[model samples]
Target: MTRVIDSAGSAYFGEAEGLLRAMRLEEALESYALAERSGHDPDACAGGRWMCHMLLGRYERAWEESDAIAARCKPDRHRFWDGKPFEGRRVIVRCLHGLGDTIQFIRYAPLVRERAKTLIVEAQPALKRLIEESRVADAVITWGEREPEWDQQIEIVELPRIFRTTLETIPAKIPYLDLPAAAPIAAYDGATDLKVGIVWASSSYNPARSIPLKQMARIFEAPGTAFFSLQAGAERSELALWRDRIVDAHTDERCVVPAAATLKKLDLIVTADTMMAHLAGAMGRPVWTLLPFHCDWRWMKRGEDSPWYPTMRLFRQPRAGDWESVVDRLQAAIEETIKGRRLVPPGDPGAQAT
Candidate 1:
């Protein structure tokens, strides 16, 4: 017997993959839809559609697409927990993506614990202590370490889908991760000043999420505000040029607890879309996130306030690749806040541009 393949479906799927790789999510989603209509196996395009729905802030639809994506992409080698009612079952949650993703989704650990008798969380090594201290799981283990016995396992990102989360129903509880009792206090001489922590760059792989340090010189020059560097990694070296302009608050990069503790002391945080934004948001601190035109879906399509973090305020680029305008608006907002002006709250039309 011979098998037949849909040539048009394959072409559309290939185009969708290329568009998604180019970060053109909307176009990729259109292509994926076309691929599905042209007789492509729904399983083959489920992951692409899921990514599009997620980036488009269509959470309910994203949730619907998750099951197929999981089945097609991550076939469970062990018993998988798919939000079923299981009593006295040992479950393990695996961390499958970047550190920022682990930080963002670890809040669901406690919710997962409610359905299982024993919950073990496997995370990146850098997050082991933080996750353990959060008390979200019964046991904590880092990846690459010896595996413990568990009856079922699921990825951390899958928890939202398993729980059937919507934009309104996101677990927006703050302070999910706590600082260790022995963590050191962040030292700064800005007791009376408006201490503003800033992060200019993110991981090099996503250059669009980062702002050039030189472009932020005007922000660092703002008066009545003390700037602290919450940056880690190679980008921290840029602080040397502005040593007199910004405080070096870079602690050990291996752990985020110290940085989280440091962020608690700041009056507000101004940062790119990095782990700092997630940490500050998770801690329930006031955070102004500067986003590019094509930002992550969690920030949503058009909103200044995040459904995931109530205390967060967004500053989005007016047009694609136009960080200058965003910076201008950020500088204005900072100056207005410094002068004690009544700023428009998030979700208000006035707050969208500035």
Candidate 2:
């Protein structure tokens, strides 16, 4: 989005948004306080502070705001888990956010399942097949499909808070969402050396989460690495321009399952901050996630590694709107890794990668 504030907004609030966008959490928190004092929306200011704390790895501070907001949002509620014990009660874990949100948080399903008499997940239809195949829940359902007997209900995002998640306490397990029976993409080239999958765009509503396809051109310059487009939507069409360089790996399949199948066959996945990134991480594949300077709370501002996903590495923009630098770093990292790989010289048992 634009750093320039529009004509109608309060100056303090505008500055706060700008600072937050740049990942300056300390300054953003102070600016949010100024916004609240200057008669800007108090709730909005609190929300901004809430995000800052979340990014700072201070879950307790963020939840303090959540508690206050939930109290105010009562009856017309946003918080779903009502802070009650539901041991032995049938629980319905509802996914009330984006596909990426559901995929990332669904790792907690097994924990919930262990405590409840039975757990059913109400997930988006696009993900129903994947979640079911993973066996994370006892059963998966979508909205308006069917109603099973459920005693306790909680939104999926609330699982972290319910489990009292701290940075150190995040469940860092891998292969959490597994579809063992998923067939490999029929068109895969079966490259044993190195096959790379790429997704350079995400929802248009959040352009910051997407990197322009042209920015990834340098990646194809590396020799001996096969590139494939795991990209979807309008961005997939952009692949036509680079046909000679990157393979269009997407299939006619409609749901998100194909990406999983495709990910399993690739040696590495390089994607924007999209559903594909979360999926690759959950599946225990090597993935490098390209994030904007000011990204979501889950990907805290300062790290190359994510606490939530063990196999995923993060590459954040050094500054706002600077995809060039991010791409430069990525290209260098790939070249280094390729050079780091040493051939074992057939049957030389001592040279195993381990």
**lDDT scores of the candidates, listed in order:** 0.81, 0.85
Clashing pairs for model 2 are: none
Candidate 2 lDDT at 126 equals: 85
**Candidate 2 residue spans exceeding 4 A from truth:** 1-11, 37-40, 73-77, 184-189, 344-354
Model 2: residue 267 alpha-carbon error in angstroms: 0.3
Could you tell me which 10 consecutive residues in candidate 2 have the lowest summed lDDT?
1-10
Candidate 1 lDDT trough over 10 residues, lowest sum: 182-191
- C-alpha lDDT of candidate 2 relative to the true structure: 0.85
- 102-216: candidate 1 lDDT, tens digit per residue: 8888888888788788999998887888888888899999877887788888877777877788887788898888775644354553355678999989888789989988888
Highest lDDT scorer: 2
User: What TM-score quantifies how close candidate 1 is to the native fold?
Assistant: 0.85
